[model samples]
Target: MPSETQLAYFLQQLLNAAPLSALYAMLAFGYSLSFALTKRADFTPGALFAFAGQVFVYFTAFGYDRLWLVYPAALALGVAASLAYTMLASTLTGSKVIRPLSQMSPNSVITASLAIMIVLMELVRIAANTRDLWLSPFLNQRITFWDHPGFPVVMTQIQIMNALAMAAIVFAAAYILQRSRQGRNWRAVSDDPFAAALLGIDPGRVIVFAGLTTAAFSAISGIMATAYYGSMDFGAGLMFGLKVVMIAAIGDQSSPARSAAGAALFGLAETFWGAYMPYVWRDLAMFSTLVVLAVVMRQERRV
Candidate 1:
């Protein structure tokens, strides 16, 4: 049996992990949506994640500076801009670049996605002049669940809201994917594009549709993260994207539920590491574990 203090600490860490894990799960599910269909790990969604948040910050700043916008108005404007840009970019990329290149070679799609990621990063860097663009945090009131003297298990309102929102989004998406005609078309294309076409399903249209939903998920996570953390670095997208890719790959990428579950587990493990291990070693530890998992999974596949 653990002591009271140790139990309190563990509970506190678990509560702290919830929001982060939800964010990871949301991003991974978005990546998996299109990955399942195309089998191409188009990394632009990573850049899209950063891009959405940065765009939100930029537009909100504009509203504040020129329009004398209030908090609500600024937030609405920022969200609209972020979603619009993300949707446009995602749809165009899927229809024009990724879909065509994917047909040629998966490697080509990967290279193109990397190039797109670099371009997005550069655009964000140039827009911000390589400076930190910050947002004013809101809905950050801490809610204490167990006030264990010196070790209170606390969570913020925004964190709870974020977790609930992501959970709702994932469940809703899963439901739609499993029950809707569009879902059937998506799965058909994912299984075999030629077969899907023979069945009168337009694979290209399904890819574009998946891309739009991916954009929606990316914008949502990006906005929530920016709002919670007060800002996100534009350059963080690559690492964020790579980490999510690895996490989703570790899961059953064919199913959103499994991808989310894997991502949540990864998130919990990562948060625990940060709590128990040296902060500097957290990323190294997580990535190393992922690499080991990848090797093990590959070997198992071969065997």
Candidate 2:
């Protein structure tokens, strides 16, 4: 049996892990959703995430401290911009003109996605006239759960919102995928596009829906991240996007639930590692674990 101190430390870790896990889960879902249609990972979401924040902050700055109007306008513009990027990516990947080429070389799709990411990031940098942008902190209020000698568990409103948003997104995705006609169409298309088309389900329509849904996930997560950190850099999205792709791939990309679970596990590992280990070893430890897991998974598949 563990002592009270051990339990306290564990609880503290859980509190710290929740928001990061939620963010990772949202990103992973974006990757999974896009992959369901294209059968390839889409790197576009990361760029969209960064672009969403930049657009939101840029619009909000115009409001001159009037949050009521600023917030709505900023959100609308941000979501619209993100969805536009998604539509572009969907068209590039699913258009009849490109489909033949992409089918011949799947890497062509990845290359196009990378190109989209680069172009968007560049556009955001030019629009902002800088690589970094900051937003005024909206929810800095904290709620303390427990206080111990060396373990204090407290969360901000933004953190709670992040977790809640993630939960809501997951439930909504599950319900739509399992209970809706469009969801059934998406699944059928993913399983076999030719068969789905024969059944009167249009693969192009499914692809567009996947892209839009994934974009919404990325945009919401971008908004939450900016709200939590109060600032963002143009280059941050690439690393975030790649990490999400890795997490989803490792988690069994076909299942959203598994991808979410993988993200939660990653969050817990990162939190505990940060808490217990030196800062220098933080990323190294986490990534090394991921590599080992990937190798093990690959071997299991072969066996």
Please give the CA lDDT of all the candidate structures: 0.85, 0.74
Q: Model 1: per-residue lDDT, tens digit, 207-292?
A: 78888888889888998888888887877788888887888888866667788889999999999999988999999999999888
Pairs of residues clashing in candidate 2: none
Model 2, which residues run further than 4 Å from truth? 1-7, 65-104, 149-151
Alpha-carbon error at 3 in model 2, in Å? 6.5
Q: List the residue pairs that clash in candidate 1.
A: none
TM-score of 1: 0.95
- Model 2 Cα shift for residue 234 (angstroms): 1.4
Backbone clash count, each prediction separately: 0, 0
Error of 1 at 87 (Å): 1.2
Task: Assess every candidate by TM-score.
Answer: 0.95, 0.86
